[model samples]
Target: MDIADLTPAERRVWEAFPLGEGVDFREGADDDPAAGASWGPERTVRAEVLRALLLGGPVRDDGIAGLKLWGARITGRLDLKYGTVEHSIRLRSCHFEGAPDLYGARIVALVLNDSVLPGLTAGNLRSEGVVRITCCRIRGPVRLAGAKISSGFFANGARLGSPDETPEEPVLQLNHAEVSTDVWAVGLTVHGQVRMNGATVGGQVNIENAVLSAPGGTALHAETLVVGTDLNARGIHARGRVNLSGARIPRHLSLTRSRLSNPDELALRISSCVIGELWLQEAARIEGTVNFRRAQVDLLHVPPEVWPEHVRIDGLSYRVLAPHRSAEQRLPLLERETEGYLPYSYEQLTAAYRTLGDDAAARTVQLAKLRRHRRTLPRYARLWGYVQDAAVGYGFRPMRAGGWLLLLLCTGTLAFALHHPPALKPSEAPGFNPLFYTLDLLLPIIDFGQESAFAPHGWYQWLSYLLIATGWVLATTIAAGITRSLNRQ
Candidate 1:
């Protein structure tokens, strides 16, 4: 593979393409700095010649092996429409005169580190290796719709912006793209929306420390994305909504210390997602509602005190609420939700506590939920709810029945002592005490012969019957509550 063996067209393009002072492409080239350098120095290359070499070039191994164009400005639009580039295009600190159109092109790999581009239109691109564009600055939008990258898409520290700054237009669009590895955009900044809707990533999507601003619109629209690993966006500052609805991430979706501010609408919509772990702790400030409706996760870790007040947790099921915190501490956090009582919310929480093997805590949540349900009932039913609550707390607090019984006994004894009712039958005892008479009237099943002997007149007779009925209701409630508790045990 000598330069003399190149075709006339290829030989002319290769001669015009500038290689630095220390690069050589003779036959049997080795990794010796004295023989030649792996990367070239700063120089400009005609876009057509560079394209010719990339499309059909004869090198030592028929690949761009020792070609590293540093500070090289490529002139004209490097269009590779439907062409297959077989070499790794590694350009560092290069400047493009126009946007390189790789539309419908298949390439081995692409690395444009520390470069400046007007814009990129690489729609329907197919790459076998990484697409590394680290620390680059693009003045216009980057369109990669329907692209397929076998390895990662690394764009760390890149700054992207659109010409119109429109909220509807995305600065970096990767819609329906498939990446075999991660999409690393750590510390990246974008002026408009970064849309990755319907994309599939085999590894994590790390956007940590990124600044994304699309005010009054979606900053990061990743709806229906399927990430095999975690989607770590910790320390992100987003001015608009960060939507991940219908996404499925098997590992975790963390937003720790992220600041999302879309005060008018939903700042984050994670509804209908299936995630393994969801982390929104460490003072993650979300100004608007974070809807988690119908989302299922194995664990949800959030600081209770710092949780956003505007959250919709309906049908959001989690096996554990805060595994790192105590049950008593986590219960108040769920109770502080501003989204009012949804019965399923409490039910999910009860199931989570039950999974933790804390049935008492689960029952407490169920009791609280029952009280919430009672509040929504009709007035007649509400009165019955009050009776049930006072007696046994919907069978969760059986000790309350003993407190009611003591209160009844004290009141009955005081009433009988104040006004003594005459006995219908003659008493053989010399001193007739009212305490025994009141006990007989209060207890429904037990009789000491005093209730039959004592006859109250007018209102007193009515009061005695009322007391007996009240005692019977309370006794039945207490017995039922005790039976339920025993059965649960």
Candidate 2:
């Protein structure tokens, strides 16, 4: 069938994700003459599926784009290698017989927005078809990288782990896409974006490395869609936790309302790639930032609800205790990690402490952070005072805080005494002394008794009790905080 007449917007947008092609060989008699010459491309079920897809026969573009595939059985490999299939090419509700390869094919517009790719194997798959299975499920990982499409790629909330030993990475790939405008793929189903090498997008994109990006709007999207800039999404929805520990996104990189649960050694890495800006803090919920180099990470318009919980880092004991690096002073390597928590935002204090070149400072910061979390993890505590030199380090000091508490106590006590002198008569009481002289200099503030101290009165009886209450509160809080500090040491 002929391609549907394209609209101006569709044509322009399609140009960004130019499709590539490659040769694929099905093990037919032609592909391998050793098979008794009986197996041919025509008889193979794989050949039939390919014919249905490319020839616009059974798997027509219109129906596939809208994801209207109900039930159909094809028992072979569907090879759309190097072929450009516009609209949709659905296999929903249908069963496959063997591992398929819709690889190296450029599939624009998807309709699997409510479909599934169940119970089969498509080892190396690449089809950036949009509107994919937001409601469907996948039992295997389908690689859709090396293939570029315009918009509507989903697979959010889809399960992505294989029950077998040879589980594939992320099933989809958007590594290098010729993106001219925005694309929407938030909350769709995906075992994962298996290959995200060099895929670029001009507009905004949605989809968490682990979950969704927004509660209402799509997970990812560009503020202003670019026409020629190819959005390289290689390693975008990578397996495991996303490692952007020290990554520097130049543009608005959002990861809102998403869940990143990968626990691999190097969860995700976005090191040294000069991006526009990372609008994360709020949208990009990560385990934590991994160690990498970065600059100009934008932090605007992030959805506050999806902020990442800082992970307690274990590597580079110095970085943890010393202090954090600034977005400007931090390394340029793209990285992420779920190692540990950072009490303070590293970017906030990087400039002030950069010149110190003190590794212990990093350790100090880390220990102080552990205290805030109250984490008794022996490792977190051990590094605090020993490897980090907790005593000599500049951390939260309870003693210093206690100083303020003492001042407050003293002021309140003095005020109460002045407000009311003792009830004893001066002639019958002890002789005048330094205590009385002290009252003369300070008895007017807070309406303290203006005419007492030496004469002795009864205001002391009532005000004294009030001041005592204030003193107890201040003293108790300070004492508790100080105790915790001492215990840490």
Candidate 3:
């Protein structure tokens, strides 16, 4: 790695490494590949030459030794696997002949901004400072699996994946990576999956305005991802499912204005996830089913209409629902739960309305729950349910009982007044009032003296028997409904 043996581009990079100054070689080079067919050896530098300088080569110790080359055509693989570099490396607008293999390497910082590469193999990489791959074009997967970065990882506006159809392979993989700070991938475009399963981020994971398309497979699979603060994916358009199952985001999980299009399959899966605030705003559109099974959210900011036709919310719990609506409006959401007859879903909806201090709406939800439960009952049980519903509205409507009682009283009073019953014994009987006589027949538990003294015959006797039967049925149904309401409270 002698300075005399270095090429012209390598010599410039070597001379500029001591003071951490950058060398620019893009003065007359064409940006388009077809037009730049004659990039000669003067603009080319061997990867080993750069690697030798980084590994304490014959450079003067001015205390600012680093590599900051710009627009150089790097030849051969920049293989630094299992190696250590104390200085930061910044290669901007460079074209790598092969992917730089930094597997199990330790470096201070690595910035490959605006670079074009075949792929990257930096799995198990330990970087003390930031790893910035901003605005780059990568033809294959960028693997950072099991990487531990102390600072942050930024890949804003990067286009990743091969032109050949391989949707099953991940374009960007950060599985099990641990980042101390944020992961900013704003406006990123990925042709295959962006898999970050089991990755842990200390700060936010912002992928706003990102476009991911893997039509038959998952677009983004961040299952079991742990984010300390927020996961902001606002305005992201994903063609396949975005699965965040078992993810834990303590602060916010925002998907505002995002479009998830996996029409036949699940568009989004937050199953078993625990989020602080889940924001699925009005503008967000999901073409397929969304599963929130076993997920817990502190605050859910989703409109009723924002939900797709199919949503599985079994065991899903949320403390508060934003922009609250009446129970009538929100009750339909519970019905969208794919699992039929899940009482927990209905109860959760009722509690949400109660938290808003809408007691009437809460009662309405309870009544609806009873009706839904009725559909699963046998024919005989359903008949009893119909009686209870008509008599007392399952205790949700208390006034209905009173109305029925008044109607029965009026029918009996008029019938008895028109045809008075004969007394059992004239000497023992007192002159009977029509209202008291009717009350005696209608009230099975209460005994007015006139009921024992008088004796009805023919049609009058049949009317009395009907009234007694009606009284027992009404009393039983009313008592049952009241007991159910109390139990619910």
* lDDT by candidate, in order shown: 0.78, 0.39, 0.87
Candidate 2 error regions (>4 Å): 1-53, 56-68, 83-91, 106-110, 118-131, 163-168, 188-193, 208-239, 244-251, 255-270, 273-289, 300-489
- In model 1, the number of clashes is 0
Model 1 spans > 4 angstroms off: 1-42, 61-66, 162-164, 323-341, 357-364, 378-395, 423-433, 443-449, 484-489
What are the per-residue Cα lDDT tens digits for candidate 1 across 1-489? 356655453444465334311222223323221212132322445577677767765455333332455555566788888999877777666677788999999998988887888788888899999998898888788989899999999999998985356744688989999999999999999989899999999999999999999888899999999998999998999999989999999998988888888886889889999999998777465788788889999999877665566777778888887745544566564554567768888788788887877877887888888887897899999999998887778877767766777787887778778887786756453244677777777667787777777777787778788878877777777777778778778
Error of 2 at 227 (Å): 12
| Superposition TM-score, candidate 2 onto the true structure | 0.42
* lDDT head-to-head 2 vs 3, winner: 3
Give the residue spans of candidate 3 off by over 4 A. 28-38, 162-164, 424-436, 439-454, 465-489
lDDT string, candidate 3, 65-110, tens digits: 8899777788899999999998899998888888999999999999
**TM-score per candidate, chains pooled:** 0.83, 0.42, 0.90
**Best-to-worst TM-score order:** 3, 1, 2
Which lDDT value does model 2 have at 118? 41
Cα displacement (angstroms), candidate 1, residue 432, comes to 4.6
Which 10-residue window of candidate 3 scores lowest in summed lDDT? 28-37
**lDDT at position 126, candidate 1:** 99
